[model samples]
Target chain A: MNKTVLQIIRFVVLVLFQVLVINHIRLGGYVHPYIYMLFIMLLPFNTPKWQLLVLGFALGLTVDLFTGTPGLHAGATTLMAFCRPSIIQLISGNQKFENIPEPNLGQLDGMWFFRYVLCLVFVHHFALFFLESFSFRLIGQVLLRILLSVPVSVFLIMMILYIFKRERKRE
Target chain B: MYNLQRFILKHHFVILFILLEVISILLLARSQNFHRNSLVNTSNVVVGKIYEWSSDVGNYFRLNTANEQLAEENAMLRQQLSIVYDTASCVYDVNEGDTLYEYIPAKVVNNSTNQANNYIIINKGARDGIERDMSVISTDGIVGVVTDVSRHYASIMSLLHSKSVVGVRFKNNQEIASVKWQTNNYRYGIVEDIPTHIVLQQGDTILTSSHSKIFPEDLMVGTVEEFYPTAVDALNKAKIRYATDFSTLRHVYVIKDLHKAETDSLKAKFQ
Candidate 1:
């Protein structure tokens, strides 16, 4: 019950933050960070596949609702959710998920967990910026948006995870 | 039926994932339609209301700059007001076929300049008599055209968008050409189809051509930053330094061309 409530709260807060605050940010005309994908990244290891896909779609659609870009976010987040299991197995050497109720820095090695988040974020952002551009003509600009946005978003997600996860674990 | 049910149960997750993804791609393509189905777009009531609230707070911080811009425009208008109407100028001519245009003031509540297809959201919409294809302009120069509108909000396809095309000409010579964004820097646009024989010197003033009723004749567009002939056939192409700084745009005017219906109906007869 506590976990379900926390996830719901995170979803609401992240979506509001993304639309209200981060959407307004225009850092040097590039770094538009989207940290809302952190919700998908932190889901429990035993999460049902159908539920993961639905949650990812919901998150992306909520963002698309505000940004006015239809399907760009939804497509990218769904792709991330679809590929999450493969990425996890590659990172942890096919370790059984039963040992880990949730994929966190506490259970997974720090470097491995970092790599997992980095890869998923890259895939998510890659699909997003490319789908948004949808043309090879502006490949330079699209690559620039991805390169700049990914690092900023990753850093923010990691900071939030550390702070929030530690507090939750204490309780 | 039994076999199909077993297959569905086994691969339900994969099927759902693919289904959602396909739906998303379709939505993306639909949004790109030329008609721009506004119902599914950002101009919808719920999202539009949220943006309006956010812009209300954001517009406060920009009050000082907006005031300065309005003051500067007011001073310029005041100076023009003092000028006696010149009978010699065509603008003053009361010809039978003359078309009159009216302006509607609006605030730009949401805008993006970085995208390949940039769009602006204004505070006025259908209730304000804003119709599709009406030209939007800032105090300085051309801004964009209205693509879609709901009850109280409208979305403009900005001049910086890759697909935007505006008819323009040289202020000094009246030599006409069409300007289009080349999906590059927002500060510049390319003027295509100028004849090779014409010499376009740098820093020449460009203005909206009278060829189109969308914009009034001789409105400032931009100055020529560079000009050259295409390698293939000596076709003259000039790069224009756009007048409106879209990044800082706040307020604008939507023009209603009163004679549009008459002219359009007349032109349709030629087809």
Candidate 2:
């Protein structure tokens, strides 16, 4: 499949999945995993900085539209996009992104890919929860939410990667 | 001029990033402005419709609890009806002019108890005569007040909301105070402004007062769980365990007071 077309399909599927299914899983009112950040993470490595920011904005705003919070998702996801390049560089040392079309489990080594996804997911959830609460009083609760959500989101994202990689291998 | 253009070209990504972030923050600020803008909320048509559909599926999981609640309420109502009817006298002592309130049953389509100002979206709306400030109650106890409405759905500001305050008093003494949610825990609320000298017991029941037209007088609010008096003024402040278990809430009745408009207008004249 064409990379652009594939990314587009992934965007739609992930957004629908996030809003329809994951949003309803109110486990003990504490953990709400946002796996839609995986969409931003899976974008082509050589994608322009400006395009990445815009895509991130669009992704976050779409989520906000569904979740009823206007700007919480947008701010956090945009920050994630801005920090992505730095995180990729710091995680995968010396290997330039120019040769890498997309960052997936297929091309990147398992340990580095896991680290990269973990760091970015952490940043995304941290920013998302803090922006949603926007309060110093419930800082403890907000931190707990982020702590509970990060691992779940990471595991879900990696599962998607594994499934997609297996499908590609079969093709 | 060339140097400036080069700088602009080089830093445009950073500029764009900041610009988008600023726009997002502005949107966040606008939505949280608390002016009760109905247009931007989740209870609007598209989102509400989707939630209504999903809730249909989710409701099945909560069926057993809903059934139990209904049965308990029915038994209680049967006992109350027996008292009101006075079976010994078939003619009864009830008057025709005593009707002051009506109720519309609604299904809870979407509810959240985790947020600071939690809102519940119910299947009822303006078309069903649900309007802002109408009181919502589950079979168990007081739920919240209607805050926003679309044609097909309405949003309720749940009692768990930080801004939610209910005028309440001890059932035995009729000593009035207010209850507000000060913590994220959905089961509890804080009581404010009770006189220090007012006697309190740990298990004393609290009821809604006639203080606001939003809720009817003497509706069940909660039971006192703890009491702490201030040192200087020595006012009785305490914690209450809410009667309605919001986590298990599925069905509720939106109370429509027939005399609310008249009372509100008359009160407005004095103000």
Candidate 3:
């Protein structure tokens, strides 16, 4: 599939998975996995920062629609996308990440890509949990939820990236 | 001028990011009205049906636990109901033919307890004897008042909420005070406006006063847990630990008295 096709497929898969699948994966009737950030993580390295942010907003808004939380997810995801480039640069130091297809753990290596994904994921989740916790009393709960959810989200996203990479190598 | 235009173009990504974030913030601040299309909302009929199906599946798995709860509740209700109404008075469950006919049951369509203007939705509405200002109470105690009624649903203010205000009184001496939830305590309330002269001893039972036409007289509110004299006002206050568990409240009843409006108007005229 071409670039547009792949992006569209990613969008559809993420939305369906979030609404139909991940929602059912209830841990203790609370904790839910958000694999929707795959869109931000897989953006092409040199894609205009504008496109990345828009994609993030769209992804977040779509999830919010399903979950009945209007801007919570959208703001967090957009923030993640906005900071992705800087985070990627930090991890891939001296590696000019212009062309070589965005976020092929093969191109950036495992540890760097993991850290890159981890930083952006933490940023997205922290913003989200903090905003949702408007009362300011539940700081411990908010931090704990963020800490627990981020690693799970990142692990799922990395597994997806790995599968895609292995498929690319076979091709 | 060309460089300035180039700057705008070059840093346009930052501008776009700012714009999107601003929109997101605005939307976040005002989320209650953002469901314009209603297509993706849980309130939508299609989405409601989908969730209903899933909840049904979950309900199946929860049956054993539900049965255990029901059995325990049944014995408790039986004992209590027997005391309230002896075997000679009546004895029948909610699902029974005769008892079911007396009360209109409604499914909770949508609900939120975390807002200033919190409301609970029941599937029954105007056509189903629900109207504005109707008294809504669970088997436990007062839940709230019906505020809005649609063709198929009605919304009620939850008593657990900070916004709920109901007429309350001291069960023993009949000291009237309006009960408003402070949100700090889930199962307690600050009953205000009791005169300082009237002694408030701890463990004093409070009940629904005749101050409001919504709650009938003598319905239990709670017992006084603590008392303090607020310096700002002449009246004393009591912290009432409520009898009912407001959080686990799932089902409620909307009262429709045979002489409701007539009795209210007559009492209003006297007042």
Candidate with the greatest TM-score versus the true structure: 1
Off by over 4 Å in 2: A2-5, A24-32, A163-165, B1-9, B41-43, B87-98, B229-233
- A1-171: candidate 2 lDDT, tens digit per residue: 777788899998998888877765665556778889898998888889999999999999888766667778999999999999999888778877676678877767888888988999999989888887777778988899889989888888888888889676553
> Model 3 misses residue A6 by how many Å?
5.4
Could you tell me how far off, in angstroms, the CA of residue B118 lies in candidate 1 after the best superposition? Answer: 1.5
What does each candidate score in C-alpha RMSD? Answer: 3.1, 3.2, 7.1
Give the range where candidate 1 chain B is weakest over 10 consecutive residues by summed lDDT: B84-93
- CAPRI-wise, candidate 2 is medium
Better of 2 and 3 by TM-score: 2
Query: What C-alpha lDDT values do all the predictions have?
Result: 0.83, 0.84, 0.69
Minimal lDDT window, size 10, model 1 chain A: A162-171
User: Model 2, residue A16: displacement in angstroms?
Assistant: 3.8
Residue-level lDDT tens digits of model 2 in B63-111: 8877888999999999998887876346744656667888999998778
Best by the lDDT measure: 2
DockQ of structure 3: 0.32
Q: What DockQ does model 1 achieve? A: 0.60
Candidates 1 onward: DockQ, in order: 0.60, 0.56, 0.32
Clashes of 3: 0
Give the higher-lDDT candidate: 1 or 3. 1
User: Which 10-residue window in model 2 chain B sums to the lowest lDDT?
Assistant: B34-43
TM-score of each: 0.89, 0.87, 0.61
